[model samples]
Target: MKKTNIFKIAFILTIGLASIFSSCKKDAGPAGPQGAQGAQGPQGLQGTPGPAGSTVLSGNGTPTSTTGANGDFYLDLTSSLFYGPKTAAGWGTGFAMKGANGAAGTNGNKIINGTTIPGATDGSIGDYYLNTTNYLLYGPKIASGWGVGTSLIGTANVKYSGWATSTDPINVGYGKTSIRSARINTTAITPAIINSGVVLVYARRNSDLILPGGTTPLPFSYDLSVVENIKATVNFSLGTSVIYINTTTSNNSLYAEATLEYRYVVIPGGVAIAAAKNINLNDLQAVEKYFNIEK
Candidate 1:
């Protein structure tokens, strides 16, 4: 009976050992293969800079253009721009001074500055000078007249005064006189200014300035008081006389005469042309020799 029991126990132990070996074999598994790589991710966004950065004009805050001279009305600034004529608001002020009469000042008059005395005629009439250094300067007077047509005619062989300089030197005639200093004489030869007449003034280039005309002939009367220089001519076409006036450049058509009236024509070289007195077209040849015409 002991031998039988030993054999049964040995059988049971072998069964348990075999079962444990079988379970260990079942727990073991096969190895897996390598997996494929994934696609690349999207790029990250850029970060902003810190504060205290420089500001620039980025938007369409376009600059405006200025017009002509009238467009000078705006100002430009570094950071921004603005227009001129700036207005101010909310204003206040406070200041005051008390007067006290002290010792009486010297019993005399205080000379104010730049005071021009009236009727200060010490300066010769027609003399041009600046009250101050910056003021305009001119020479003595050569003529004076009132109205638009008043004039001054120089004496033969003699130049007018007021300019202080001899006519022979300048060769240029005296211009219009300034009435501010000397008064005008509104006589028979009154200037046109009195009756819608145009006021003109000019200087002769040489003595030949007042020449006679080819057709019409008349007397030319001018002011003698204000002429600076002059030269007498031998033109006999001016049957009566010739006068050179200081007139404007545009008044060149003053040489006209009616029938039975003396005809005068202003010619080139400042010469006034006129016909001989009482000389008809038939007798023109006789007196023509006396007047000295090229024909």
Candidate 2:
């Protein structure tokens, strides 16, 4: 019996130990499913700045405000810059110097005619002289002796101060007729006969004349002709000729008067006509003299 009780006690002890072990022991339950992720954090602050850097120099020398001349070239050391010459007032931006002027050249030789006259004085191309005997101006010396100088007479020599006119009444026939006439008397001037002479004549009708029966006057038609002679029938005298006006009309009853205006000039001898050039009327002095106008 005691043996049986001891076996029962042993069995009861075994049962208690088994109960305690079972209470202490545990089994991992499949890592208990993963947890959810967390939210993102705010950004970090910026870092502080480092020390300042050194300056880099440019150009030559330093920068300066120095006075310069007109054409001087220079550089500013302070600002490391280049410039032109400096004057007393301030620096200049233009050329610094000017060159000297050159010398005048020698004149060329004077020539006249084919002869190359001896004792010819030094003179310019257009130098001229009036010949006392012939009363002509000569010069503009060329290789050939004073080439044909200008004629001091005629249109070239004399000035036409004014004009003179004369009128004559006439009756016209069917054909052309010498209706009226006038003359340019060479004796009228201080010198009767000029070495070189020139004359100008102009003619026209004074007014229109009506025919006997017709109310309207026929158109006046006329022409002029100059002749050099001493005939009593001729109107002009003493070296000059007479200028005549001839008129004509289809109507026989036409009566008209003709008028004439004329001027002339006389030139003495000695001027080289061949070498002389024609004078233009535009020359103020010549024109004034020709018109007999004072300037």
> lDDT of model 2 at residue 274?
26
Winning candidate number (lDDT): 2
TM-score of 1: 0.12
lDDT of 2 by residue, 156-212 (tens): 344342445443544433343233333344343443333343332222233322222
Best TM-score among the predictions, by candidate number:
2
- Residue 241, model 2: lDDT of 35
lDDT values for all models: 0.28, 0.39
Residue 258's lDDT in candidate 2: 29
lDDT of 2 at 130: 49
1-295 in candidate 1: lDDT tens per residue?
9999999999999999999999999998898887888899999998898654322221222234321122223333332343322224211121222345588875432212121211244344443333232121223333451101101222111111111111111122235321111111222222322233212111222233242322222223332223423222211111112222222211222221100121111212211212222123223232233233223
